[model samples]
Target: MAFKRVSLIVAVAENGVIGKDNDLIWYLPRDLKYFKDTTAGHTVIMGRKNWDSIPLKYRPLKGRDNVVITRDQSFQADGAIVVHSLNEALEIAKKAGDEEPFIIGGGQIYKIALEQNLIDRMHITRVHEEFDGNTFFPQFDENKWKLVSKEDHAPDHRHEYSFSFCIWDKIDDSQ
Candidate 1:
């Protein structure tokens, strides 16, 4: 079976930080809303740590199918489908009829997916500020991706930092 699209969705800081410890470092409500809105009906694949970071009340992420990747075979997330690998998670999503599953991650999962070239598109919320963090988004070659769209947002009463929502599609070498 094949998928029409498989996207990676994340919020990164100017310095490439994605999180601190196992939780998000910043509190950008707009970015959170964007994530929820964009991936509402799709399957969200995440690592065990990422799944763990989600508050209990929001586990299974209400409107999405939560696929959690973990090495521990006995580990079970009550409301999520547990898989041993990213490929396994993808297969579950594919079998569930999700054409465009989203890889919503922790540091390791993102690195593995990128290294395996399993991503088709990326939806990124670029926060325009540097932060101190232990986890980071992997660096990718800009030449290999085409920026499809970008919408910039300025800081306001509700938002502390300026940010931009950017969509990038992987460049097809065949063309």
Candidate 2:
């Protein structure tokens, strides 16, 4: 079956930390808004742990199709679709008519997607500071991605750390 654009969206610290204890370590409201705005009408695929980490009130992220990947056969997520693998999740997203499906991850899921070469684009918020964390965004070869755009924001009364919103597109090796 044909698929539309597939992307990964994440926020990473200077040290590549994304989260800790299955939760986000920082409170970047602007970044959060950016995430919501960018993904409002698309499908978001995530690992089960990532799905659980979301607050109860935000479980099925509003205005988007939530597809969770889990290995447990009996697992169920109310208001969200649960699948056993990334490929299954992607299929669901495509069948749902999502023009661009996003992989909103926990560490392992991100690593798997990268290793499988399943991502076509990436939307990253690069936090300027580093923090102690158990979850890290998987590293990829910078040479294989082309930075499409970037917007920097400095810390203000509302934001603590400086950050840059970066958009990257995977280089088409077949070209």
Candidate 3:
């Protein structure tokens, strides 16, 4: 509830690989469907790298809001509210009526959001595999978060790789 809620969605391999040269670690269709289903009608916040990495067909993510952050004034996408900083992103999210803005990431952007206390929950799908990576997820701090739920899933015939969906919520020190 600090500003608007932010949730991070990521698929990391067993070896902690999040991305390889600005692309995803794997090409599993199931993961894509999971992403589309969860975020289909939500506001999404991301940095320039994440925005550029989005394919044209999935650019604005049908039926959802897209907010992109960048220092470049020319960084604009139709239907995506572009901003210069995280605070601006929050302001844009404010207009969306207190809905959680999904923090679909690229390494640096996720780092910034985590450091800023913007991420409220993490919707991570851990792929049971490893890959060569150019970018990796930041080490999660258990002191700041707690795993709330998880669902282990078998690989669909199309995906060929098993995965676990996890949800982590912020930890309260008041307890």
Residues 1-175 of candidate 3: C-alpha lDDT, one tens digit per residue:
3444578899988887899888876777877888889877777888888888888887877877888899999877777889999878877777776477788887788888888877888998889988899888888787889999988888777778889888899886787
- On lDDT, who's better, 1 or 2? 1
What lDDT tens digits, residue by residue, belong to model 1 across residues 64-162?
999999999899999899999999999999999999999999989999999999999999999999999999999999999999999999999999999
RMSD of candidates 1 onward, in order: 0.7, 0.9, 1.9
Compute the lDDT for candidate 2: 0.94
Q: How close is candidate 1 to the true structure, as a TM-score?
A: 0.98
Q: Which candidate leads in TM-score?
A: 1
TM-score of each: 0.98, 0.98, 0.91
Off by over 4 Å in 1: none
Clashing pairs in 1: none
Worst 10 residues of 3 by lDDT: 1-10
Q: After superposition, how far is residue 163 of candidate 3 from its true place, in Å?
A: 0.7
> Each prediction's Cα lDDT score?
0.95, 0.94, 0.82
Q: Give the TM-score of candidate 3.
A: 0.91
Please give the ranking of all candidate structures by TM-score, highest first, separated by commas.
1, 2, 3
